[model samples]
Target: MNCFRIDESGYTGFDLLNADQRFQGASAIAISDEDADRLIKQHFPKLQAPELKYRALSRREANHPRLIGLMRDLLSDFRCVTYVCDKRFMLTLMFVDYAVEPFYYERGFDFYAGGQNYAMASMLHMAGPTLLGKPQFEALMAAFQRSMKEKSEEALRDLVAAARATNWMELPEVLGPLAKYAAPECLEAISTPDLTTDVALIVLQSLITRMEVMSEGRYRVAHDQSKNLQTYTEFLQRFIDHDANVEFRATEITSLKFPLKLTAVEQVDSKDSPAVQLADVMIGAAIEAANNLAGLRSGGLDAEQVLSLYADDQFIHMVPSIDFEEQKRFRQGSQSGELIDYLAGNVFGPKKR
Candidate 1:
């Protein structure tokens, strides 16, 4: 079985609405164990820095010929799959009205009129059952209603303060039910950009897809150690077991399956694993490319150009194509366009040639 190493960059925990977090992505690098050992021994010693990271290389050796040469060599040596999400566009497209508004309407509250009160109501309604339990959620709703009637933000603030005083896990329960209510498509859309679950799904899918075509669908996957490793592994196992389907917008629906066999999934330290370090470098490059696309940076190697140098389709696959026109519309502040129409035109349409 072939072996692949995975790593991520540009994760901002789970704050989907944070404007500062413009990008989120992950990368998987496929190589045989012998090739991995050989490549690291051959290339790592030539680097001036002890570690292989995109940010450090960009900052300290942006103009270094050796660094550029090393990057080129790494790209040529491994098969990489990367997925990047534009967090700002994703949030605006998925959450604001379609999710938040309908959630409030279901509870007989006018989301627009209540402003912050409405926001608090939506949060409590979504998170209540899961995090606060049904009883506490209902009580919080009662408090919020009282505040809304009296035109005060105090009750909502108090609840939020209490939630903050507890664990961070207690705070983001809003994501789950909100995603469920949004249903089949909305859940996928919302989760697609998530730092944890959705990102892992796509990365694994990409790896499986590439392996099916290139390596007879057989591989052992290794990843850099992460707090979410178990969760990610469970998700992958479930997808394979149940034949889960992944829909890209509406353009394509694919069964998340491997044609051959997956031998193992394991985690390794990047400090000790050259394969994981290479995955890190690949993700770093992807992050830089995403930043350039978002206008956060300028004048560097475009990610597409680097992928082209490898001369293989499986070398790099960017989830949600950077060329997607709806992304352009969202970036241009035209989010008021009908969601269905947008999906039909951009996502559900036949793949562009």
Candidate 2:
């Protein structure tokens, strides 16, 4: 049976709006225990730690070069994939679902029918602050987060207050289709918003899709996030028992039968599993690479090596779309556009001839 070591990074529990770590995700790598050991030994011959941690190694000047060498080796592997999501973008999407989509849904229509969700998600992500003011926009997100946790009267009041504070006439571009739902009663529809399991399932689903093709549907997930994802055992257990269908709704419908090739999901300790440690480096590199693209890490970043080493489709980049017009209006596309183009180029590594 094939074994894929999986690990998640940048998770802040159910709170999606974490300030420090904006990216949360998981990576899956298919490798034997022996290969993982051999690679680690080759790179860190005088290793002293029980586990090879990417974050720790990147911090030390002497070890940074070795870390990059190890990452390049890992990237050379044929089978690996990383799925990352922006927490704020996820929350912004939820707001559109709760406050905006329902109005269209009531009229026997799909809110996301015409790439509308992408447009709205991008618009709200960028224009929301301009339309509602940053404070109110944040309050509304907090309200959405709280409302989904449980029925909180405080969350409801905050939602109402945020809606009441919005002057629809100011930003008609966003408020045009959204104005109908700008009222407090319409916003009250945000009673359920579960983002916790949402991300985990996406990570798992994407991992399963790629693993199915790579392993011929015969593999078990060796997960290493027992603390933050303790509840995931049951969800993964479904695959072990029967052929489960995993589906994701986005631009299109993605559905597949699982356990056809998958056996079980074992929650392994990272300290013992070199495979999981390798997965750690892969996922951490993905996050750090994104940070580099966003200019989050202004200082030296050995992790930037991931940009060149990454396979075109290996790393998934899911960042929020900034209000492009607003950016152009302020900087005349001098700063933001240049950064955006640079990021795009790095994301896929110069086009093939």
Top-scoring candidate (lDDT): 2
State the TM-score for model 1. Answer: 0.54
* lDDT value, residue 351 of candidate 1: 16
Clashing residue pair totals per candidate (backbone < 3 A): 0, 2
lDDT of 2 at 264: 73
- The 10-residue segment of model 2 with minimum total lDDT is 332-341
Top candidate (TM-score): 2
Task: List model 2 lDDT by residue over 1-353, tens digit each.
Answer: 77888888887766788788777888888887789999999999998998988888767778767877887787786478888888788777766655665566566655544445555777778778887788877776776677656646775666655555666556554444334344443344554323222455545655665676677646778877568656456556654565434332222222344334877788888888898899888887778766667666643345456667778556665556555444234323122222222322432133110
Assess every candidate by TM-score.
Answer: 0.54, 0.79
The models' CA-based lDDT, in order, is 0.49, 0.64
lDDT of 2: 0.64
Query: Model 1, range 1-353, lDDT digits (tens) per residue?
Result: 67777777666543433456567777677765556556655655556655566566556544434445656776666666666666533332234333344454456654333133224433443444567655554443333233223333463344344333333256453433333232233222222221222244444555565554555555777877777555456655544443323222211322223223666677777677767777776677667776776688765566565554454453443323333344333334222223233322433332111
Return the lDDT, model 2, position 258: 32
CA shift of 185, model 2, Å: 9.6
In candidate 1, residue 302 scores what lDDT?
64
